[model samples]
Target: MELGVNIWSFIDRILCWRQPCACCGAPGRALLCPGCLADLPRLDNPCRRCAEPLPAGATPLCPRCLGPRPPAFARVHALFAYAPPVDRLITGLKYHGRWEAARLLGSLLGEALAGADPLPDILVPVPLHPRRLRRRGYNQALELARHAAARAGLPLEAGRCRRVRHGPPQAGQDAAARRRAVRDAFAVDGRVDGLHVGLVDDVVTTAATVNELARVLRRAGAREVSVWCAARAGRTSGT
Candidate 1:
């Protein structure tokens, strides 16, 4: 089995060798060139609680997510820090209607979480309000979740939750402001009773949004919730 896996990996590498790097225009590179891959700002050392970046050899949890009134979600998992090229990737999918970008980002997150010790039973994409959905023509989170569910083989439940309130964007909001912005923002529409749910989103900043969703999910009978984002912004996002 090991030898067969290695052989297939070698063949895949050969096939990918001819594709251009996604971020850089480097020729004859795989999904990303080696340099871009190394510089991707991977959150390999994340807080066990919020998935925030931690110093090498530091404790498992971040100070912000440590205090009382802990998050409704069990934990967060992510693949990258929301930095330059990574930000570009997210924005491309979010604003430019780039479906391929969603495919790349979602597949990356899904594959990373595929080997998670305890995977969630269902994946739920954060919903967009009806007005925003009509304006944007699609829910970016759902787009991301579709590819993630396909890659990870996790069942996706899109209608379980809905955004009942459409407030101002959470961008540029501090933690307190974010908490306020998302207050009563979500409503549970379908049954999630006694299930472990993986909340899928494009990015996680202070986590105010997902935490609110988790809160609603729990009230709707979710056993546990965890966040899975393509990227995690730094402390500057009010983390």
Candidate 2:
């Protein structure tokens, strides 16, 4: 049995090696080449609650998300603002069949989790409803969480929570409308008692979705919930 397991593991690694890196097109580079990895647009100064770009020395939460405190925790950390090259990368992942982008994004998320002042006990990817999952043929958050879990050395509970409803995309909705659309959309599948859960998502805009998911997790006995996202979209016409 041990020898068979070792052989399988070796075969898996070989298969992985044949895939091209998602960024920079380097061979045997996991998902991103070193050059592309170095070029990721990292946010140096961002709003605390939403990760929006802020002027140097500015307050954490932007004026918008602060008028009323968010339903989730008081802080959110995003790796980059949703713009330009980063935006293009995300679009490629979502629409252009670039699944390897998830690996690159996950590595960045793992770094962010490592540098966090407070770390979570477990990582949970925001789940897609069954219908949506079938329609899209993949869940980007799950792909990211798998890579991030390995890099962070944290347990990932992919089945601990689930999306119970099929709701419209939160984009193009006002804050209030977003809240209504996502409210009670998530359900906890197992015990999270006393655990600090980190919720992972591909992007954050109004944050209504994360807020609702956090509420359900907390109600299910999670001690605390923190949200992490790859990008934070600025308030645009749809937002």
Candidate 3:
């Protein structure tokens, strides 16, 4: 057991290349080069409600959000639209234990939130079930949130929320299925009354996971919940 733990610890230390731009293998640059960073599929002029990418100067709210029913979370802020290098970086940190990916991606998340008008009072990383946490040895969301919270000058509360359900993997699942899988799956354990809570996650696809989590946080007396994801993803056919 000790040997296995040590092996994973080592793996976690070098999940991906630190310098030389992991994506294009260009030397001298950091994990991501400036050219690649500029070309990344970022969300431009995103909707305030869902963070859906919109045309420049388009309406602040998307047509869907203009409807009567909105989401449980008040807003979503995302840096990139889940694609290509961003997806690879996230996958490396999430599955292969690449600590550097978290450093790079988390720093980018922090940079994006640096000048926000209203930042959340506290950062709460979406929890992973104990089973997954033990298997992975770290929560990617927490790792990313650590950097973001530091840059944003906010407190990170990793223990505020807990995931009790060990649902099947959510990748490629549509919104409705994900909704069904995560219903009542989360429990809030900390005091959040009147506090503007920021929920951090690695990726947002269909927004089902964050939405369910927001419901739980609100029930626990949070003033309002906002989601901050490193990337916004498009729903897949199904995994």
Candidate 4:
């Protein structure tokens, strides 16, 4: 029965005309073509602390994050650098109204989490403020989390965290400025005692937002926290 369903789904996808890759009219599943996927600007080596792509042979932590570590326990994993095809993929999901991209990005995130040295107990996407949720109609992070959770077979805690404050977008902000903007922004919605939580996001920049969120979860009694993001900006490492 499942095989029959799978075959039907595959055929349906091949016949569907509405959902083709914008970059190349591929008949089946893909936001970007295989050729485009190969051309994506990948981060070779990112900072261990903040997951920012770094120059070749640079240290693990960027100077800023090293000076005063961000609030999380340790380590961040990013699938790609915030440039070119990756940047365009993220932009399409966030702004151009392409939600299906989350499925593709989420699958990669799930694979990365699976390879982590220590796996987390629960997956939590960074919460969107109520106002932003109303405007956007869907939380991209949450959508990504749902897809990743399905792929990884990890439990997803959608209601475990809440955004208490809504602020301007973090674009163009420096590290310190971004930290200040997101401070006290998140609160755990339920018990997290001794739970190892994996936080998901579409991108990580200064580590400010995730740091602030991890602090909240820790304060709520979480035992450990790690971050998983689809893209990282600014620094790099060989991992």
Summed backbone clashes in each candidate are 0, 1, 1, 9
Candidate 3 Cα errors over 4 Å, as ranges: 1-18, 53-64, 237-239
lDDT of 1 by residue, 27-140 (tens): 854566788878887776788989977888988887776888888899988888888788887888888887667877888878977888688999999999999899989998
Best by lDDT: 1
- Deviation of model 1 at 76, angstroms: 0.5
TM-score of each: 0.86, 0.82, 0.86, 0.86
Off by over 4 Å in 1: 1-19, 28-31, 55-58, 237-239
Q: Provide the lDDT at 199 for model 2.
A: 90
Clashes of 4: 9
lDDT of 3 by residue, 1-239 (tens): 99996896576556543568877878643677888878888776778898876678889997767888678999998988888888888889999988788887887878777776577888999999999999999999999999898778889999999999989988877778898999999999966899889999999877788988999899888888998899886556232
How high is the lDDT of residue 149 in model 2?
80
Clashing pairs in 4: 45-236, 45-237, 46-236, 46-237, 52-235, 53-235, 53-236, 54-235, 54-236
Evaluate residue 217 in candidate 3 and report its C-alpha lDDT on the 0 to 100 scale. Answer: 90
Q: Which tens-of-lDDT digit does each residue in 59-144 have in candidate 2?
A: 87678667765556546768777765677777777656565577678877888888776889999998999998888888888887
Model 2 — TM-score against the truth?
Answer: 0.82
**Colliding residue pairs in candidate 3:** 15-98
lDDT, candidate 4, residue 104? Answer: 79
TM-score of candidate 3 versus the correct structure, residues matched by position: 0.86
